[model samples]
Target: MSVTGAITSGDASLLPGKRDEDWRWTDLRGLIRQIPAASPQGAAWAWESPLAQAGGEVVDVVNGRGRSDLDVPAGGEALVAWRFLSTDGAGAHNAELWVSVGEGGKLTLVESYEGRGAGYLANTTVNIRLAKGAKVERIVFADDHAEGVSVVDASVELAPEAAYAQTVLTHGARRQRIETRVAHPGAGAELRLDGAYLLEGQHNADLTTVVEHLGVDGTTSQLTKGVVRDQSRGVFQGRIVVAEGADRTDARMGHHALILSDRAEIDAKPELLIFADDVQCAHGNTIGALDEDALFYAQQRGMPAEVARALLTHAFVGEVIDRIEHETVREAAAGWAGQRLEL
Candidate 1:
């Protein structure tokens, strides 16, 4: 079935586009050419995780289906790998996952969306629930087909004293959007969200998130960064809400981007809504090119112009990249960033 046919059975009359405030920067209807039929499950895709060193369980999801052969440990620490395999022709793939963490359990999850070929689409939905005192670390990475489109939506709920941390790295495709929504309903919860994007050629990448603080003494911090070149485009939108009676809530969000080429574009929107008088919430957004002075200093040290440029670009987004807890993932992200910058 086509994308229209699959979505028409739902509530919305039209696909989200420029008319919707949340989707204004992204026009999904215009980007998707034709959605192909559901792909048949095939061989398992090859994937590796550094978290395996910690004896963490690994679960793989190929295409839109989960691999039942591997076992997922119920308690303690584990790693779940969400993979989207590539298809041959025009088509769409969808995946929905639900994750629940037991009390005081800790888990590390990775969502990796990638594939080969052209003119395909991928859609994913993720839901996570954390019991009291649980802790979770989530990493998201996307490097899809050059001519493909991808969309992802993730929602999370945290109980009292629970903690959730996330890090994202992406090499954008033709059209891509990854959005997340999180809610804290219990006291003393904490959240940390961080993401980075590297876009080249004519690719487009968007990261949008909404965090709601609904309990007393909740805390949240968010940081996002991007680097766009070769007429590519990057977008970031983050919103934080401190509901009424959610006293002592502290939330802060910051977004920054680097425009490597004159034709490249970057857009950022950070919003905060607070109804409680005892809350502290703030947001910051910035978009600009590399500092000429910094680049010149590196070149003066005998570094080639291209190498200097790469160094400066890496430093710009390294803050978010270095925050990743997985050593293997961190190396992969750094390598991707270097390749994207042509360093």
Candidate 2:
């Protein structure tokens, strides 16, 4: 079946609605009104350094069409490439990319999302498989326009003794949502996810994730942070699920948001589901305004309020930024955040 058909027929199961448990918090119905059925013009394509490296495969999706010049590594299996277009004036198109790493092999996947104009929706998905003893790092970046709307879905499956890590960065749009799902299908696996969102003006963004421990001796960790300014809105919802047979599982999840204006808003919900007899899993969520005491102290020390707030916001999001293993990627993300905050 076609991608658009699958979504409209409820086969994808990620549609936004009250019946969908994972999408109950953020409604996509309202955002659909802003997207147009036809594609827009003047969509520019550019690849900055660090992201254009040839070591790993790079996949670029523009308005739901897939384009890539990177060559697949030798011995790689089950790689898929396709484009998804939107119909019925929904203003959203989705493309799904799949990569399966071989046993004891390493793979890096980079996915980029860019848009053209207002009333455009781009929904993209990436699936990664790590065989036994294999390792993979996945990085995703979204540079959508101010009037664009985007939704990204990423899923990873880990085998025994495998490692999977993912980092996501987004500069807010009219409405943007990123959802991640990770599952450990074999014992002794590890998964880590880090995400950051910077929203300004009337833009809205959300980062939601779910990690399922289906194997014994599996571990997972996730940290997400957001900065909302002007009249923007940010949301983060994360869940960790430990199956009955998955003993010795260790999982932790946390989300923090900094609201920079009275008009700005943030909503966070972190959850844990444990069916195992012996396991350690916890989750936390926090949404608060800038620290008055800290701002006052900084002011007393001759620092301006704007500078103080910027510093604190940077520090909050920097936690995830520091976890990025690549120095050049980390610096690029930090620079993007700084530009968004006008700091």
Candidate 3:
């Protein structure tokens, strides 16, 4: 049912492409003419892992192999650093991981995707479950090889009274996509999903998410912002579906981006489907260049052109970075973006 599934199983027939509505922009089948050979096992992570200095239980999946599950006991609290690393440029591989948080448990996840080498393919799938009254915050930073292709799919399930929040940041690759789907069982549960990307060259990045509210009194909030230069591309697809009888569901989704070059592209689709008459749902999308007046204002104040541009861009994307709850993780995210924007 996934590109990773087809690649690992050698079933090209199952690959997703332009024919599939969700994968049209990504078009994995078209980009990959032939699946590469299987990747070798036991590749080491040699880069400075994100949030590594913060210190926590480290779980690494190298070359698609490592511990595949994590659990937080009832009323427990945990801080974990989960990493996915790809070091081979010759072939394709995949990994699947599961995380569970018991009732009243709290979990903070600092995740990283460390990919190296060129012309490789990598896929990762994660499933998360939260019991009633549980709380979870996941922050994912993707630093992949610019010449490689990568995809990440995550599914989240939340029981009544549970809360889940997530933010994803990526620099993009030859072709990279991150998809998140959430199953929301209302009864006062809450969800927040956010993403930010800085893409350049001919690279591509896609952030897609779907949240389905099956019961009453659920709330969901989503926002995504991206910046692209050269001929690179950025895509954001967000959909929220509230089934019949799912009354009092409040959901809002927004996608905004800035294109710094005439050749760059940004595609966004934000949708809301409400079967309940009393639900409140809305969606918005905006794609354009930076604020010219603001840029000029900063320059007039004595800042150089590049400095002014970087300052404005940083403030624009900093909204999402500021949402990261962990202090160390938030600073790390800002530093990553600042370095990319040359701030």
Which wins on TM-score, candidate 1 or candidate 2?
1
Residue 178: error of model 1 in Å?
0.5
Q: Positional deviation of 261 in candidate 1, in angstroms?
A: 0.7
Residue-by-residue lDDT tens digits, candidate 2, 68-175: 232334344222212233322335565667777778776555555665456666667667767788777666677677786677777778889988888888877787
Q: Give all TM-scores, in the order shown.
A: 0.91, 0.85, 0.97
User: Where is model 3 more than 4 Å wrong at Cα?
Assistant: 46-50
Clashing pairs in 1: 36-91
| Clash-forming residue pairs, model 2 | none
lDDT of 3 by residue, 27-135 (tens): 8888787777888876665547457788778888987889999999989999998888888554788888899999999999877887778877888999999999999
Alpha-carbon error at 21 in model 1, in Å? 1.4
Order of models, best lDDT first: 3, 1, 2
Residue by residue across 108-141, what tens digits does model 1's lDDT show?
A: 7777787666876677778888888888888887
- Which should have the higher TM-score, number 2 or number 3? 3
Q: In model 2, how many backbone clashes occur?
A: 0
Q: Which candidate leads in lDDT?
A: 3
Predict model 2's lDDT versus the native.
Answer: 0.70
Candidate 3, residue 115: Cα displacement in angstroms equals 1.0
